[model samples]
Target: MRQQLASMLREARHAAGMTIDQVAAHLLCSPAKISRMETGRRPASQRDVRDLCDHYSVDTEKREQMMALAQDGRRRSWWDEYELPRGYSNLIGMEAAASSMRDFKSSTINGLLQTEEYAREVISSYFLPANPALIDQLVAVRMERQRAVLRRDPLPDMQFVLDEAALRRVVGGPVVMEEQLGRLLAITSELPSATIQVLSLRRGAHAAMDTTFTVLDFPPGTPLKPVVHVEDVFGDMKLERQEDVDNARQVFQRAADAALSPGESRELLEEIRAQYEREQPPER
Candidate 1:
């Protein structure tokens, strides 16, 4: 709801032909505050919403809606339990609400497909020299998201395209990678909505090679807008414009087309898992 409100408020401001400074002046707040509020970076207060609504001469019905949105922003969510970076929290929140999603991961297994052991290694490495407790919390959050999004009924129209390098990478060592690969193989049968494809090395240099991204689609008739999410060194970015979503979708289609079919992906996963199995030392 916070995101929805943010979009609505931003659109309303444009419709009213007011600048951020203008709204900030009316709300008696900083321009940065108004900017953040419109971008979902800062939560808008009741007074902020009411003052802005009145300044724009908004209709009573619309004012009520914006007020309700401000209040809705305060409501607790499942991801709120864990203290997480705002971007990641928002990503998970959006993921939960999405009715369909496309995930294109280049370096590691998609979070939804990671095993607990694999996740631990990935998290531990990302936040190196960090607290074990924080690692546990982060891992716990991922596991919960997996169950909530993937291990349930009425699953999202999910499509995951894993680069061949991701499959071959020895993340968390041989055992963990093997288990993670096994999970990928099992997921196709476990969840009918999910389709896993492998972007083969044979297809060298695809459209999404430069970066890893995801496009999440919200259900129709919802205020929530579909967003194209990109994760880079700087952090994650959420692109909600229609053109951005369209471009991301086009890139995904090319990558998907270049990828191995579901059955072929399973075969490749099996081959990799077997290699990892062989690499395991002799039992005591």
Candidate 2:
């Protein structure tokens, strides 16, 4: 909501033939503040929206619309309850609202598809020596996101291109990985718009081998720009420039082309699950 508001604010400013410096002078604020608000680095308050609307001589109805958007931008979202890094929290919120998403997961399942146990292990491993309570909170947040995935109105497009390496990597051990694969099957089945393609090890040295990222598209006719999320061991980042977004999409398409078909991916998943199942301890 904040992002959409930011875009609208920019468009309004552009339409009014005002420069950031001009607006800042009128509003008695620094040009940097105006720039941050327009770009969504800092959210614009309702008063700010009102002042801009008045300055632009916008119609009454349009002013109301911008005002409502500003209010919604300030509202707390579901992910705000937990003590989370702001970037990660924003990513979850954005993922939930995206109209479509293409995710290339190099090392693990997407958080929205992870089982509770799998999530716990992943979180605990990364934030080593974490308090037990924190791990529980993190896992709970992941599960909540999964529940939201099912309940979302007007289901979004979900495309996941998973590396076979991620599928084979033992996350929490044999049994855990086995159950995690089963959860993936179940969750993907539940999402009617979901598509999964597995990139086998045989398809070596692909275009996306060096990155794990997700590209998100917003609804048509909205001002929300498409975004690319690049994630790594260090952290995550949001790339909003059109060129960066286009480049990410091109890379994703190339990688997806070499991946297994949806049917083939499911077969591979089942085969790996059986392997893990067989590795389980024998009954006494």
Best by TM-score: 1
Kindly list the per-residue Cα lDDT of model 1 for residues 98-163, writing each as its tens digit.
899999999988888889999898889877578899999999999998888885567899999999
Write one digit per residue (lDDT tens) for candidate 2, span 152-182. Answer: 8888898999999999899888889999999
Clash count, one per candidate: 0, 0
In terms of lDDT, model 2 sits at 0.86
TM-score of every prediction relative to native: 0.92, 0.89
> Please, what is the whole-model Cα lDDT of each candidate in the order they appear?
0.86, 0.86
Q: What is the lDDT of residue 72 in candidate 2?
A: 92
Indicate the worst ten consecutive residues by lDDT in candidate 1: 146-155
For model 2, the superposed segments whose C-alpha errors exceed 4 Å read 10-26, 30-43, 54-62
Q: Clashing residue pairs in candidate 2, if any?
A: none
Q: TM-score for model 2?
A: 0.89
Clashes of 2: 0
What are the RMSD figures for all models against the true structure?
2.0, 2.5
